[model samples]
Target: MGATDRLDRYQPLVLGLFRIVIGLLFTSEGAATLFGVLDRDATPAGDWPFWYAGVIELVCGLLVLLGVLARAAAFFSSGAMAFAYFTEHQPDGLFPLQNGGLAPALFCWGFLLLVFFGPGSLSLSGVFRRDAAPERRG
Candidate 1:
């Protein structure tokens, strides 16, 4: 098969994988927030942040699973992990032994990888492939 044909053939597979990963992550996070596994005081200063986070996770997770706006959704997901890592995981120090920091850092790093690599040719993003050739005359 030609390059274009090969890419087209594999596009769905790539997208499906991306969708699965993003869906699972978002669903897991949403479940934690909604179930209060990651609990926090909903105080007067910001009463709804946790709730909003939970809802976003739930909805975005579903969207990612559907391969809708997967890149942007993944970016936000990555941002969430980064925020969590910086705020909660950095207490001990820069290294892994410090305050259970390694896991969060690694998670954030993986998210960043997803954001940058962008699910590759195995995504809905790949399905909407933009040809390199310049526009031609009608």
Candidate 2:
């Protein structure tokens, strides 16, 4: 098979894998921030933005991971990442590398992709989900 054909055939699988990895990483980040379990300091409870962001990351990340309402979760996550980048990093520098905004910027775009493309085949929603029947008009 040609390279393009091979890539096309495996695209869904690769997208699924990518989504899984991204979800796992995002969840890990939240866990680290909220519970201090993964060699990261816990954000103090009631802290402005960080704690709240951790909550979002945990919930949305799980939703994205399981491919349950992933589009919605990704939408929110993307927005949050954009917010984090603009508010926290953009003021420091214009470039992502210079501003320490790489993660947020990448996540924003990545999640935005998910929001549009949807969770690929290897998902809970795909396994047990059924399309609703169309109603007949009288």
Winner by TM-score: 2
The lDDT values for all models are 0.64, 0.90
Report the C-alpha lDDT of model 1 over 1-138, residue by residue, as the tens digit: 789997887765675686677577776677676765656333232346656666767776765655567667777766776776677667657766766866546545655666665565445445555554467799
Q: What TM-score goes with each of the models? A: 0.57, 0.90
Q: Which ten residues in a row have the lowest lDDT in candidate 1?
A: 38-47
For every candidate in turn, the CA RMSD to the true structure comes to 6.5, 3.6
Deviating ranges (above 4 Å) for candidate 2? 130-138
Give per-residue lDDT, candidate 2, residue 74. 93
lDDT (10s digit) by residue, model 2, range 1-138: 899997899877888887888888888888988999888899999898999889989999988899889999999999999999999999999999999999999999999999998898787787767554455699
Which clashing pairs does model 1 show?
A: 14-122, 15-122, 15-123
